[model samples]
Target: MTTFDLIIIGGGPAGYVGAIRAGQLGMKTAVIEKASMGGMCLNWGCIPSKAFIESAKLFKKVADAKSFGIDGIDKKALKFNWKKAAQRKDRIVMRLVKGVEYLMKKNGVEVINGEAKILDKEHVQVGETKYTCDKMLIATGSRPLRVEYKGIDQSKIMEIDGFFALEEKPECVLVDGGRINACEMALMLRYTGSKVTMVTESDSLIPFLDEEIRKFVMDKIKKAGITVYTKSEITKDAEDGVYVGDNFVECDVILNAKRRRAVLPEMGDLELEMNGHFLKINEYMQTSVPNVYAAGDVTKQFFAQVASAQARTAVNHMNDIKETLDYDKLPVNIYTDPEIAYVGFTEEQLKQKGIDYKVGKFPLSVNGKAMIEGETEGFVKVLSETKYGEVMGVHIVAADATDMIAEAVMAMRLESTVDELARVVHAHPTTSETFMEASYVAADRPVHI
Candidate 1:
């Protein structure tokens, strides 16, 4: 029996960060990971998907060179070596994995390479070895959910996780989710010359986002030549296509972007509280079992771009440096062509909660930088308290909106008023000026239309 002061199961963003913090606090720690050090986000989900998206963007740029006054651009003659693209993504994943391993060594945390199962509250079994610790953290994360339609098997259909195995692009692909992944992939694949169709149960894409932004994204997706079907469900899987209600859509590949659930198969032996399979954690991220903590997608927290934010909160809780996690200021991003980044509540949410709020909106067509960049497509919406003028929420959809929303997030987190943001001087002819304009509009003053 091996013993340590702290033991972490699943070497992911949450587990690795927790282990490092525990080591910094002078506790001996060991982290057990069944697969790679960086887990799904690094190995399969986030990093790899971004790399491919970037490639798709670059390919689109070259394909559209003629629009930039550059003639004799033959996009059909251009070819992509998908094997190289896969290798490029693999290299990035490998580097990040090595970096995680290096951090563990620097923090003097031991690494165990095997699947872990909790024997008791503080004891974990890995293969033939059993280890005990004073405290344990589980950050196993989540896996993509596969819908069990007739003839849809592990062999024919591919979920988001398995979609990365392809060395070549499919001729036609069907994306079966209406949210971020589905919308993004539908646009990217269609732009990259694959006949793509997006099917969703909802009437509009990305239903969680603001209604205005959802409509804008849907229009852009349509303009990209991707067929969009709404309020439809896939009933059966045929040889090369899926039957949605009465119509069968033809496609060579199917991408499932349905809801995901926490991957906690080994938790059956542990005496922990669970809402279905998701581990239930308190405000301090402590599970039902004493000294056992769970974070990231394993917990009941909402899944989005706020994953790292939640991981940081969980790290503080695990280290006992913070008494509670403040989840009020989480920022969410949808990585579409005109990305949507939002922090705090939506107008509908505020209305439902009976919170009186004022809204300010600035369209991208009026922004000088957007017009110059030729990517004018979305808008920035700011919501504030009706009486006090304090910033309640900031939502943006535009080019580099993911990067630009940080300032708004900071302002909202600091409880800054709309007047404060409006008064601040932003650089000339920039997308950031849109924030300033929106803030001004929130105050019922407009400089530029």
Candidate 2:
């Protein structure tokens, strides 16, 4: 029987990262992955989705050339060659896969290309080969969940995974999910001239965000010409398109964004403390079984961004580092036209926790840069503890808000006070000034409204 010091199952972000770290520590490590390296994020989820979004953004820029003081562009009818777009995305994915392979080789981590089945706590079986390890890590990722409904098995109905495989754009697409993926897809396709409708089972889109921010996102989505349906349940049906609550929504494609569960089919032998379908882990990311760690989407944490953070935290713990994973400071990004990004607690969360807080908001219309760019559609909201003036949360919706949230995340993680943020001078005529102004407002000293 072949053996190693560490064995990692699943080749997604967590598994690959852990494997590399283990290899660097001079541990004999082997990673078993059934599919390509880099898992769903590199292959199908994050990278591919972002590639399509980038193309859509470029298409919009070219179509809206007149707004930039450029004329004589009589290209009225813009077309999307989905085949080439998909090919571009696939090439990028291949490059990333090769990068992971290079990392594994450089770190001296053995790569096993096959499906792994857990034979016991110390043993894993891959076809005819069995390997034992002193330590094991289960980093298997997740897949789109299919809801139990009548016509869900039909060809017209699709999941988020199917978006990459689509050779052509659908006439009208019905997207069901209230979170980031659903809103982003609805906007992307709508911008490309597709009739898009978003149906959410919840009361508002992005229910996890602040209620005010959720309302703002809903309004933006509606203004972008995408129909928004809230408090609706999807029933199964066998039709040419998607049906919502018995109404046959004439859609060429139906994208379901219900939820994702951990992919852990080979975990039958090892006992796990599961929160629903997600493996339960402590702050250290240790599972029910000792020396067996679980991270990323496989754990109860549903946030993809948080999953990567947790993976790093788990690595630190494995190396006997003292740092504990703190979800309180994790930043989240929702990739819409006017992107939404936030860190720390929301106003609602603060109220629910009974923490005395104050909120300050600065609209993008006031920012010179936003007006200059003609993308003024969102705002920055900063929350602080009323007594100490310590920054608690920062939420933003604007161009590059996804990247801007990093500053706020750092502030919250460092426990920076509102006064500290207000003291820092931001560049003139920049979107970053919004954060400075919001902090000023939080501190009750606003220079600009």
Candidate 3:
């Protein structure tokens, strides 16, 4: 009987990250992954999707190359090779997968390639071999939610992974769901010159965003030439197209968004509490079972960043370290043309909680770099307490908003106020200056709005 300090199941962001952290803390660790090392994010979801997005953006840029004043480039003569783009995405994924494998070896974390099943709170079985550990962490992640409709063809309807496997772009696409992934795929497909119509079950896309930000994004989605049907869904299929209620719309492909449930592997009768389709976990990511923890998509924190943080928190608790997870402070990003990133309390959340707040905003159109790059289409908005001026939330819609959101995350983490944000000197001629400008407005002194 082989034994170790910790055994992590599923080698995605949550599992791999937790294994590496355990190694650093001088604990013997083993990660059992049934598939690729980097999981869906690196293999199919995040990395490959972003690679395709880069290609689409480049194609769009080349189509508009004349705006840059470069040469006599003819838009009509430009071409994009979907096959080449697909190859590039594959290469990028393989390279990152190798890097993760290398890290596992360097950190002394054993990589077990097989399906893992919990035999008990302390013992896990992998391919007929049972291994004992002091602690067990489940990071099995989730799978795309599948819906049933009349006259559905499995060949035409696919999920994110299916979309990534396309050798050629479809002429028209019908997408379902209103999550971040849906918005990203819709924009990317539109940029690639595909006719896209999205039917979302919710009244608004990305409904959790600040109302102002949500409206702005909805407008942008429409402006990008993608049709959106809110509070609607695909009900039936006809020879001509799919039916949303009684209306029939034509589309060659149907893509579903990111509604997912925990992929809990069969464990015989090892009982674990579940919340809906997800595993129930405490603030420390601990499950109802002793010495067992769950994180990432399996535990309801769906984003990759949040999954990694939860993994670390679970490891910290296993080592008797004092740290707790805070979902409120988690930063979220949507990779649209002009990206959107936000952190801390949203206006709606604040309203529901009855927290009195003030708003400050600065448009990117007025920023120096935005003008220089000719990509100014969004703004930075800050929310602060009316009484203390403490920063409650920050939302940004710009090209580099994803990268800039960490600053806001740090501000809220440190409980920094709008006055301090305004007093700090920001370098001139940068998009980040928008944050300072918004802060100035929050401090009751308008400057370069």
Candidate 4:
């Protein structure tokens, strides 16, 4: 098609999702992708990393299986097959990529493959073909940042793609970065028997994490035997080991966590207002130019979930359907050992805003399901406003923390109070029951400590 009602640039979660919604609303949509479909999250970043985590968790389970009555698990005999795990990760990534392609076809959206150059607001040129659309969406996500050091073997430094390309795990691995991917990778490799050491330039490990959750994760990773050093510097002597602030760490490979900036391609003379490195957008996801909208990593929000929602909301606005996302209620999930997920305000944030809040905490060590599964090492903390009893935030650290955080998201979406959640009958003996119990504690009536 030479023309479309809407043309979306970059076929990641943002562009593809917007295309589907636009098609459903009877808009002639076309999505132009320069690289693979499903973006970085589905293809390499999120999906593959989670698959690795699953494998790593299995190793931990096998090591601890003696208590669960699984006999004959010889610790010396157990070995993790890196090739098989990579094969599985690749399989899962491919399946989802195909699914995205299928969705594009089913939704009556044309998928064009090539680098998109925005000729203007109404025109996008991919090679020689100049397609025009009434409105355009910029969903092009970020590119990974490269960190360089004066070293003897620069070949050892690997990005996400490079590390995934390895046939097997490397001995004496030095992990770099302090984000979700870096933390997950360190733990995964440690479980798989790599001598892993982590060093990051950030002041705090996973700076965005809730303080309590951060402390718990720090303790867990230390106990897991992954050496961590923050605010690190690569000191002198390029021959042997890299000194991370005097703690010399020698390794065969350096795996970097994916740190990225909003990387936009050349777009002729079009200028986009920048919010730091990302595009500035309105509440409806519209850019400075009314007809040109942006979402995903190209904009302020980074989470795939936020990007998808922003794109859909932008599509709704284009169709004259006025709707906007709840910015404060957006959930941030981190795939650490066990897991960390939370939505709304952190205690620090609440305190900073001078909001009167009460906290309710329920430890998984006391939960029946957790005790039965022998994964009783986390807790759920609920924070609510004292005056109206409205839920301010919900933080969880558990095997199913990401899954359980959804209920809190829904409650916050509906503006449901803690009293309401406390009153609702949740199925007993599940980790989610902690939510109600935590709410009870917040209400000053604790059934279980």
Candidate 5:
């Protein structure tokens, strides 16, 4: 048996990050991972998808390269090499995995490769070996929630994991879900020359997005020639394709893009309180059991950024540091063709909370940089308190909206008012100017609206 100061179960974003922080605080830490160190986000989910998105975006750009002053460029000469793209994605994933391994070594954190079974709050077993720690963090993460229906065969249906392993791109695909992944896959497949149809049980795609932004994205999706069925379900799985509701749509493949649930590892005789499938954690990410904490997808907020923050907060709480996470200022993003990002409360959320707020919006159509790049398709919207003009939320939908949201997140974090944000001069002919303009509108003195 071996003992340490902390033993983290699972080496994904949450587990590995927590291990590094614990080790840096002079606590001996060991991370137990059953598979690759970076887990789903690196190996299968985020990194690989972004790599594919970049390739698809380049293809789309080249199709319009002639308008970009490249007079002699032939759009017909362009062809996508899936094998090459796959290889590049794999290389990027491996390099990052190696970098994480290096960090683990540098921080004096041990990496163990095996499934961990928690014997108790402080004791865990991996195979025939036993280990003990002063505290345990169950960061086992989550798996895709499988849906079952009549005539549905689990062997035939392709989940995200199986979707990544697809060698040949389908001629027609039916993407099922209304979440970020579904929107991304639908756009990526459509841009990659596939006939894509999206079906969702929600009223619209990305139901969590701001109402206006969701409608704008839906319009874009329609303009892309991809069929969509909302407030529907796949009632039958036919031989040629699936029947979404009563409509039989012909497609070569069905991509299930449903929700995910916390994957609880084997914990013998240690009953932890659960909120559905997730292990409930407090503001500091401490579990119901003493000395046992949980973070990441295991606690409901299923983003890498949220997971990493929770991991750090858990470690800080363990070290007797009085620090907690604030989810209100947490930024969220979707990496579709026209990326979507937001920080702080949405207008709907503020209304529900009975907070009187004012809204200001600036369309990219009026921005000089957006016109130059031929990427003017969205807007930057700011929501602020009516009385104080304090920035409450910022929602963006544009090509670089994800990158631009960091400034908004900082403003919300510092409790900056719209007047302050408006007074700060932004450089000329930039997408960031749209944000400044929106702030001015929020402060009630509109400029270039």
Candidate 6:
């Protein structure tokens, strides 16, 4: 038996990242992954999706070339080579996957290619061979979910992997589900001139979004010419269209972009407590069984960054560091056209928690830089506790909102107050300056609106 100090199952962000950390701690670590080293986030999901988004944005931009002082362009007959973009997406995914492999080698973590079957908390079997470890981490991640709607043709369906694999654009697309992946696909394809419609089983699209942000996103979706139907299901199907609550919608493709379920490892009888679909973990990332830990999608921390953070925390605990990850301090981001990034409590969450909070907001329309960019369609909203001025949440809807959110995350992590945020010097004529401007509003002082 090949024995080691740590054996990580699943080489996604969580497993590979944790393996590197464990190697740094001088533990003999090996990672077992059935597929590519970087897992779905790199091979199929986040990286490829973003690549397509950038291309889609470029196509949209080219269509509005006259606004940029570039004339002699036909907007209706504008040409976009989607196959070239798809090729670029493949290249990007390959580059990142290889980079991760290099990192594993540099960190002295052995990369094993095989499915890990849990023999016990301390041993895992891959094929006919068994490997033993002093500590085990189950980071099996999740599989792309496949939902079969009633009266839907199976041939029209495409999952995330299939959507990215397409070299040509479809004429019309019906995106099933209402969560992150669905929203991303709908936007990415629609920007490339596909007639898109979003159908969800929920009451509203992205229901967890802050009410203001949700409204902003919905308005954008509508303006992009993508139709949405919430609380609707596919009832019957015809040759070309499916009935969505008495309305017939035609589509060349039906994207099954539902929320993926956690890929529970084959753990015969070695029981681990599960919370709904994800493996239950403690503050230290320890599973119910000692010396066994779980992280990433398997534990349902779907964000790639969060998965990596949780993985490091698990490794830290194994080395007696006693460090725990504070998920509350991390930003939850959605990559819409103008983007949506937020950290901490939403207004709804604050009200539900009964916390006394005050709000300060600055629209992009008032921002000098946003006006300069000609992409001024969002806002920066700040929330602070009334008594101590402690920052409760910061929400942004702008082009670079995802990047802007980390500052808010750091502020909350360091326990900074809204007054401090307002007092800080921000470079002029930048969207980030809105953070300070919004803080000024929260502090009862007016700046640039």
lDDT of 4: 0.87
* Candidate 3 residue runs with Cα over 4 Å from true position: none
lDDT (tens digit, per residue) of candidate 2 on 1-449? 99998888988788888888888788899999998999888888888988888888888878888989998777666787778888999999999999999999999999999999997789998999999998888888887776766646566668897688788878788887888888888888887779988888888998989888888988888898887778887675545565677766767777887788888847657888898878888888888887788888888565566766676666667778746766889888878888899999999999999999998889999899999988898999999999999999999999889999999999998899999999999999899999999999999999888
Off by over 4 Å in 4: 150-152
How much is 178 displaced in model 1, in angstroms?
1.5
Better of 1 and 3 by TM-score: 3
Q: Ten-residue segment with the worst summed lDDT in candidate 6?
A: 143-152
Q: Whose lDDT is greatest here? A: 5
- What is the C-alpha local distance difference test score of candidate 2? 0.85
- TM-score against native, each model: 0.94, 0.95, 0.98, 0.96, 0.98, 0.97
Clash pairs, model 6 backbone: none
Question: Compared with the true structure, what per-residue lDDT tens digits does model 3 show for residues 1-449?
Answer: 78999999999999999999999999999999999999888988889998998899888878877778888888777767889999999999999999999999999999999998888888888888989999989999898876775577766788776588888988799988788999899999898888988998789989988999889889999999888898888887777568886778789888878588889977766799999999999889999986899989999878899888999999999999969977778899889889999999988888999999999999999999998887799999999999999999999999989988988998989899999999989888889999999999988998985
Please give the ranking of all candidate structures by lDDT, highest first, separated by commas.
5, 3, 6, 4, 2, 1
- Candidate 4 per-residue lDDT, tens place, 225-329, comes to 988888885554344456777677888777767477786867786787888878999989999989999999998577899999999999999999999999789
Q: Give me the overall lDDT of model 6.
A: 0.88
Q: Which ten residues in a row have the lowest lDDT in candidate 2?
A: 234-243
Error of 1 at 30 (Å): 1.5
Worst 10 residues of 3 by lDDT: 146-155
Residue pairs with colliding backbones in model 2 are 150-236, 151-236, 151-237
Please list all clashing residue pairs in model 1, or write none if there are none: none
* lDDT (tens digit, per residue) of candidate 6 on 27-104: 999999998988888888888888989888878878777887888998878777889998999899889999999999
Per-residue alpha-carbon lDDT of candidate 1 for residues 382-434, written as tens digits (9 for 90 to 100): 99998989998999999888899899889987899999999999999999999
Candidate 2: lDDT of 246? 70
Question: Of models 2 and 6, which has the larger TM-score?
Answer: 6
